[model samples]
Target chain A: MVTYVAIGLLAILASIKAFHYYYQIKRAPSQKQLSKLVLSTLRRGQSDRE
Target chain B: MIKKIAVTLKPYNRVPFVYQKLKICRNCRHFTVLGERDCMSCGKTGGLQPVEKRAAGIVRRDQWLTGLILLLLIVIGLLFSASALQTVLLIAAGAAAAALLWTLSKRFTPALRRIQLQKMFQQYSYELASGLAIDHQAAIRVFQEGDKPRTYEMLREIGSLVHNDQLKLEQIMLLQTFQLRKDMDLMLEPLLMDSFSPDLVAYIGEMAKIRRDLIKENTFRYMLQHEMYILNMPNGETVLAAVAGAAVRKSRYMTMYPYLLIRYARLLPKDRFLRLYKFAKSARSGPLYDEVMRIYEEKFKWDPDFQNA
Candidate 1:
């Protein structure tokens, strides 16, 4: 019974880690996308001035 | 006889200015301008120079005293360790003595010296920030005469008072003196975040946006959010309304707006993007207004529902 309980806990921990990695992957691109948007805005500004 | 008289008169004329300059030094509570080389007042040789008061001598003396006290405590601790009770008592006494010495140094010497040093630096920084040429000798005196902490505090205070673009531009030239960009950013952060003063915020935002630092993205995001919030609110003052209306009309957030609009449009079945589009269309035309309209038309080609209206 104790062994079974330990196995369950390990499974839960593994799932949590997997979920965390997925969340990080999802959030990382949003920050990059925001930066890209700002860069593009700056480029557009330069082009307009020219 | 005339040449001799002229020389004597010249010497007499210069004596008043010299005396006037040294009057404060002579009357200083710490002054000891005895005939001997050493100053009897502060116990240092040649310490009473014909200049303004400085704290460098006090700093050196305090450092020496702290070091000596620490050495004495270490020796005392080593001698008393054979008896555990005596060792404990000796340790406690040493700690108390150190604390007392620290308090005395803080209250009597370094604290007062730091206040004087900070005042001197503040005056120098204010003059520099105001676009006036700083006296290099006075600046060097401040740097050489004050402790590091006192100098840093004075710089921070002076930097915080800088509100004009010219002053900010001048102050930013001194960024090299600070260890981290965040220290300078902290001094600028409040001015940038001021909600009621859009022009100040815009100026700070422009400066931050130009810098290839983390502050650029952070400040832009803050400005964008602030503009959006001001626009969404119904009852805003003229300045807030003008800034928001200008920002929206100009489409300052054009690149990011489509992504946000698409998401918001998806959440609202009534199509909120159309409302924003109409609002932008009706808003007065400016440089930003034209840009905003171009982005909306290019990104979202929603059929005009007003054709039947």
Candidate 2:
């Protein structure tokens, strides 16, 4: 019974990870997001020097 | 005649986003935008991979882990199966789930990679910023060592990420030392400043004379806003005329910046005036049309080229 229960839990966790992966793929970043990444990181670099 | 120093400058590697040039150490995960070999932080050789490749590697690892979990569950279920029927059912279910996941990942590979890249950047923003800062310091140290050309090259690489007025000005000041040659790789748009500086205007004028094609709307606009200060310079009219000549290269410029021609039409060299004359002949009567026509009459009335035009 304990072995069966562990199998069930692992199966459920795998499905959950798959679901998260699907959403991550679906909501992939746009051009604006990449541009923001560039601006934000550059801004951080400037502040760091000061 | 003005002399120009000729030097071969390596063309900059172009990218849609500057971050694309970054390489991260797979070992220490330290990021750097410099050369793609050897982790500068850990001194480990051959441990660096391009950021996108690193992101894709992470995606593949996650995918493998998920698949392995499903496989492990099926094996555990089969080991404790009460009947042959239970064993078959567990195998079929696990196989189906693995197939579905493999197909999904294969189809969404590009999207998965892009999403992973965004995540990687967010998670490692601090490391990436520090890496770039270190690159900047290294460049400054080179400058201190009095290798002006080498220092400029280093700054140019770092400028891909660290774009601010100070960096732009430093490049301009260094450029002022070297005689700018038309054949050398020079960039104007990246170095354009938000505010006015005499050094910048002089550079613009220099570019206008040699690389007229680099003179675009931003440059025209810059010159227009600071026309008074430019006029105060001994050769200001000459600079303005050279810029006007660049405008004549495109009909779009003639239509877009008539005011520029109106003010400096007479100062334009003969060839530029001929082009403006041809444009003026087609005008339906804006201030630009009138100015070009008046200049044509006043300056080129008896010239053979004007008569043919």
Candidate 3:
């Protein structure tokens, strides 16, 4: 019975961790996307200044 | 590299004298006037640096909440489990997983970038402050050469070190050289002087109208005590007009504005006082408005528009 309870708690914790990992994956922009956005913005700013 | 060029451009390498002027009150971030060692706002000892911006409270709140929830889960596990050793092991594994996930999420958060930028700013400001302390001319060169944001940071640190009106005034003049689109009003607050030059008075008046909320009590006090000097400036009346308008718009400045106007009433010309009286009446009717009316009556022998209103 003790072993069963421990397994249940671990399952719950793992589910929570899995959900969090999914959220992180969805929200965070990839490095390539960020760099491209930055470079484009910089180019536009320089052109505007000139 | 810019810093190197700036030093080479200095004329005499004279200790700019202005860099060592004012101290920032760490508690309230108020700039104490020269010769004063204590902050008037919080009565704290003046320091060389004001507190920098910190990460938002929400980030920290989330961190605490995560820890608390994990602890609560562990506690529940301990209570329900029959074997203490198994429960301990389960709790430890759960805590490790949660902490790992928390660390991973925190690394990707915007707060990470904010912290990184703040660290960069702090290091740059420290070097700028030390360079200015050692050689004033070198600092000026950097100010001229550095981009707007860099110049902004340099001014922020230099503001904490100013000790006199002259230095404060010079700081404003230096700021005028930069045509930054970003609102530089808050950073400029510490450098506001009691006796503004004509142009500075106009700038103050413009800033007062646009960013009235940023005006500190010290500013009103300066206007009150140095009424003669401010009123004599070319833009003195305009400054007073803007200040009066600000007082009417915001209840915060209303406390000082009414008293300041009354004290300066006896000194103001008839037309000027009349203008102030009209401006004060335009705000919502209050005890302050009535008091201002009474002052107007006493000075002018009668309130011209009071009966009509």
Candidates in order, TM-scores: namely: 0.22, 0.89, 0.37
Q: Give the poorly placed runs of model 2, Cα more than 4 Å off.
A: A1-14, B1-4
| TM-scores for chain A over all candidates | 0.54, 0.60, 0.55
Clashes of 3: 6
Listed models, DockQ each: 0.01, 0.47, 0.05
Model 3 TM-score? 0.37
Interface RMSD of 2: 2.9
Residue B47 displacement in candidate 2 (angstroms): 3.8
- Which portions of model 3 show Cα errors greater than 4 Å? A1-50, B1-131, B134-136, B143-152, B161-167, B177-185, B194-199, B262-309
Which candidate should be chosen as best, given lDDT against the real structure? 2
Residue B292 displacement in candidate 1 (angstroms): 16
DockQ of model 1, rounded to 2 decimals? 0.01
Q: List, residue by residue over B1-309, the lDDT tens digit for candidate 3.
A: 112112111111122332223344455444322234554445566433422222333346655676676666666667677877777677677767676757665665563433432333333443333333433343455657855444434445444543356546655665455442324434436666655465466556666656766556766666566667788887686677666555544445555567665544445545555555566677747665676677767766555544444
Q: lDDT by residue for model 1 over B1-309, one digit each (tens)?
A: 111111111111122221112211222223211123444433454544432244445455655765574555546455545556655555555555555545544544433444333333333332222221122222334557843333333333333322333334333333323333322333344334434344444344334323323333344445456755544444322223222222232244433344333223322222334455555466556443465456555655565563221
Q: Report how far residue B70 has shifted in candidate 2, in Å.
A: 2.3
For every model in order, the fraction of real contacts preserved is 0.00, 0.39, 0.06
* Cα-based lDDT at residue B105, candidate 1: 48
Overall lDDT per candidate, in order of appearance: 0.38, 0.80, 0.52
Error of 3 at B79 (Å): 43
